[model samples]
Target: MTVDNLPLIELPIIDFGPYLDPSSTAEQRQAVDHAIDKACRHLGIFYLVNHGIPQELCDKMSVIARQFFSLPFEEKRKHKVGGEVRGYWFTTNAEDLSNIPCEGIAFHPPVNQCSNGVAPDIDPASPEARLPTTHDALGGQHSWPNDHFRAHAEELLSHIVPLKVRLLDSISNCLGLSDASRKLVQNTVPHIAFNSYSSLTKAQMEEGVSNLVEHTDPGTITILTQDVDVVALQVKDSDGKWCGVKPIPGSFVVNVGSSLNRFTGNQYVDTLHRVIHCSEKSRISMALLADPVFDVVIEPLPECPFKTDLAKFVPKTFGAFYLDQVPEDH
Candidate 1:
């Protein structure tokens, strides 16, 4: 079938059951590869099924997220800038300023090292003590009221971090890397965020005022779990048409980010994407941004680099590149 006639629903939903099975047959591996190729090509998006994250847990997380966002503005503000690692952010607090119009890209800058104001009791050397900065704005202390939210947020991280590692391995395999070469991702430090967009009025939706402007994610990989009925996410198709991505119940969307594009020497495409504010309902989403550890070197893969002139390309450490592009606080 022609690309247009093939299916209105062209996005791929990949099943991970085969990868988890000890006795998985060769055909199963081939099937997985096929899915990965298609997802990386036609649309830089995919639905992951059988990923082992419990449906009940996802539902509970969603409910709690809704509750958290529903709190009075003042109560929610208790977790605002300048406290510990957990809190809330208002609309327009974090954004990317580099885009000429800053239309679709919501860039959140990194927390500045000096002003983070982390508690004295929490040692900086501790792995768990680092905080995700407020969206590309000022990096000061996170203002969380108590320990309850902190504990739950940590629990969610515990569940998803390893899954992210495994998925990265699968991605590495798709690039024909050896098992040991998967080490390319080992030292990566990933950031995760739970964000809820306030419901927009019909007029706001029509004007695209509450919608996220188009931009590509800057990290290596991004995995997102979104509200089932919310239909605001959209990606540019090969034909440059805007296509809506409907959330699949019990699945997450995975997309490659800019870092991965550089690592693959641009062999794999990292497509542009954005979100529209829901007109009929508010939307909640959990986003995970995974990148190599600060010290890990990011160079183009050997095979892919030779095809393009390596001499003209610029090389910068992953951390340096990310910090440079952090969205300026509005």
Candidate 2:
């Protein structure tokens, strides 16, 4: 169910150029902060412009993603996930995502700790029970493509990690958070993903199959961009109606996720978004998501920018809570 009324059309398009400029005035920074705060509380999403990511890098990542996904099914299958959902795998037609077949990979930073148990209120049968690999090795290492395109693909993550740092810091300032609360965000090791959505016929689109099922991100924040000329992003408004969002050239779609929703005392809404069937062309997009080191506690701070009643936070550990939200297929 949705809890907001602001339409996606009127979404705030925030410019980051000013914030990054060395000579930017305090007033300009404050304006940016206000924009972030408003969008998160009202719509839970916003478009980010002038984020300083080179256009060439974005284009290169898209090209490499399309190239990799275009490989023969057998070739891609060689890199498939065995048990952990970290490498390349085919996305089957589930009931919710019918007609939209896709595949993607998730890459987490070096992590060795097995997931800590969930909060006392969680169920034993939950996905949270699926612990990560332990023993000092980073869990779920991604299987890089076997082709020359691998370098370009890997470089995408390099650019994305630093971008996430800038984003989280800005978000911290926007929330007027104390250093203690900000630590939850700063401790997050970025996770990068490359997704390729396959083309769908008109008939399949009419049959109600979307490129993805509606869901909210489990991480703290998500920064994503679609390939030029590809569109079909839809977000559920507070009225619970799906609204399409067209691509804005060279801009990124940013959304607060459920993790931040919890820690922010529900001040920042975790938005539900989806991609729909697009005729002819397959769509490629990449996302950089962030969550604190698995064991960090996510409790609402005493000071929050949005008007929220702090009574709702359940005080769950980041890793345990994120595992619980993983889709069964993953």
Candidate 3:
């Protein structure tokens, strides 16, 4: 189905209030579920309102993020660890789309500390030394500009992480898999990024340089919110036309990702999107990308409504899937 045919304007506005309310009626909850299902299968994107995340917290997060991004390049890059997954990555006119022209910092669960205070005999440079045997290779201690930044980031995540769990449950229900889908997410280690895309210079814009090239997120789900009035996000429809998604105040843009797309046997759309310069001001957005744990198999759910005689894809571990999507440099 083309995006034009969907019963929505640009994107559906879903009231997550019903899903979070204990007193909401069954029909009210079902209405929420149906709206999510339609959006996922048709466009894989929607504007989520009444999601219960405090507006003040969101505002504070944006404020701190901009402060961090506005710091001197040397001050910010002090925490950057080369060839590591969990640190600041600053790129300028990247040769390929894999790394766009932006400044980004990622936060991940920390590596486990040895309880006995004795370092293992393994080589410190080896993968085994940096990550636990059970962790995704991406798992490690995060690098932050300072404790103040870390505190606010974690506080925001404290609220978002739990909300994502509930969202996984809702998507599971939409797929008719009940708790099965939720179970896959139990061990998920989320990777969230605070990214800043500086406005294109007049010369760059005239040269048709891209800020973020068209691509689909590889995780199970991506929850994103950008600074107010920074309208650069664009979604591509089935007909190959791109439409800008206006940022709604206090609402998050949620979309199904590749991992979830494969789980449903490609039944749901994993929308393609990109970013372009909208104004002279820079753009800052927080993206929380959630995927299953390292060892979890990503296969079509047996209970999904779209299950067919032949599986659409071969089963692969989420870790392997993630590795395939990473660029060679990092």
TM-score of candidate 2 relative to the true fold: 0.84
What value does the lDDT take at residue 27 in candidate 1? 89
Q: Which is superior by lDDT, 1 or 2?
A: 2
TM-score of each prediction: 0.76, 0.84, 0.84
In order, candidate lDDTs are 0.62, 0.72, 0.74
lDDT head-to-head 1 vs 3, winner? 3
Which residue pairs in model 3 clash with each other? none
State which candidate has the highest lDDT: 3
Runs of candidate 1 with Cα error greater than 4 angstroms are: 1-9, 82-87, 93-146, 178-181, 306-313
Could you list the CA RMSD of all candidates, in the order they appear? 7.3, 6.4, 5.9
Between candidates 1 and 2, which one is better according to TM-score?
Answer: 2
lDDT of 2 by residue, 45-67 (tens): 99999988888988877887778
Return the TM-score for candidate 1, rounded to 2 decimals: 0.76
Task: lDDT for model 2, please.
Answer: 0.72
lDDT of 3 by residue, 90-209 (tens): 764465333246778887654333211223678978765533443335544567788988888888888899888888877777667746565774446676888888776556656766
User: 52, model 1: CA deviation in Å?
Assistant: 0.3
